[model samples]
Target: MSHGPFQAQPTTKAALENVAGQLRQVLGLEKVDFFPVVKVLEFGLPSIFENFVFRVKEGPAMGDQHGLTFPDDSEIWLRDDVYEGVTQGKGRDRFTAAHEIGHLLLHSQRFLSRRMGDQPIRTNCDPEWQANCFGGCLLMPAILVKTCKYIDEVMDRFGVSRDAARHRTKQLNLSMQEVF
Candidate 1:
C-alpha cells in the first residue's frame, strides 16, 4: 500500500489509512482521538514545526472565513466559526476534523521546501482535493463508499459535506458525471 515517489496512482482508502498510520507514528498521536469533529493539532517536521501553535479567539475579531495551512510550519488552522459554518449539525463534526487531518497528512510534505513569503497563499495542485480524498477514505473507507452508489448517500454515510463527497469520487477515480 505504499506509493513510491513519482507514482500517479489514484487516492484510495488503504492509502488514507497508511497516511493516518504514518501520522500516528510520526506525531505520537496516541492520546489524541480520531473522529470527525474533534479540534486538535499535532506538530512535526523541524522546519515547519512551529506552525502547530493555534491562535484562536471566541467572539467578534475572527479573521478568515476558511481554513489556513502554514507550509513553513507544516500546520493547519481551522476556525471554529468556519467549522460550524461548514457543518450545521451537531454529530457531523467528524468530517471536518478528518478533512483538516487530511490536509496535515497529505499536503504537508508538498510544502516542506516552500518559503514563507510565497505569492500564492496556497498551491494550486489541489491539496484541498487531496485532503478531501484522505478525509473521505479515512472517515468512510472504500467498502462504505462503494455500497452507497449515490453521491448523497455517500455524503450521508461518510458524514462529509457535499463538496467532500464529490471530490472523494474524483479522488477515487470515479466519473461523477457517469454516476448520475
Candidate 2:
C-alpha cells in the first residue's frame, strides 16, 4: 500500500491555479461560469469516469464520507445522500464532488503506480489537503473571485455555499467593501 512519488510535493496555490486553469481550458469554461461544474465533471472529463465504474451506494452518514475512489481500476463510489445532494445542486455536494475529482487528478497517478498491501502507505504530504485546495481553487478561481463585488456574488455565481465563498474570499484576501 505504499504510495509512489507522483507530485509528492507540497500543495501550492500556484499549482492549484495551474491545474484549475488547465481544466477550464479543457472544459471550455469561462471564469464566470462556475455553475456548470457538474456538467464539466460529467461531460468534460468523461474519460476519467467513463472507463471506470461510479456507484452511488449507501455509506457513512452525511459529512462522514463524501466519496471514494478505487485505485486499482479508478472506480469512484459516492454516498447515496451525497449523490442526491449533488444532483439537487447542493453546494456541499458540489464541493465534495469536486474534491473527489481533485483526488483523481492529483493522487491517482501515485495510487496507480504503487502496489497495495495490508499496511497503508503514509506519505509526507497530505493528499486530502491537496484535494481540498484543488477543489476550492477549481470552484473559485482567484481571478474570478477577485472580480466579485461581494462574497454573496461569488456564492451566487459559483453555486458554492456561503461558507465556501467566504472562505475563498478570505483565502484570496479580497476586499468586500466595494460593489461592482
Cα-based lDDT at residue 60, candidate 1:
49
Q: Which regions in candidate 1 have their CA more than 4 angstroms from the true location?
A: 1-17, 20-35, 39-62, 69-76, 85-96, 106-111, 115-129, 173-180
Candidate 1 global lDDT: 0.51
Can you list the residue pairs that collide in candidate 1? 36-93, 36-94, 37-93, 37-94, 48-73
After TM-score superposition, the amount by which residue 165's alpha carbon in candidate 1 deviates from its true location, in angstroms, is 1.9
Instruction: Give a tens-digit lDDT track for model 2, residues 95-163.
Output: 888777777676755433433454443433556666777788888888888888887788777878888
Alpha-carbon TM-score of each model against the true structure: 0.51, 0.77
Q: Which candidate leads in TM-score?
A: 2
Model 2, CA-based lDDT = 0.69
Q: How far off is residue 71 in model 1, in Å?
A: 8.0
> Which tens-of-lDDT digit does each residue in 1-180 have in candidate 1?
111222122454566657755554455642332333333443243323544554333334446424555443555555676556444643244555566667655654543233335334332334555565566656655544555667777666556667767766766666544244
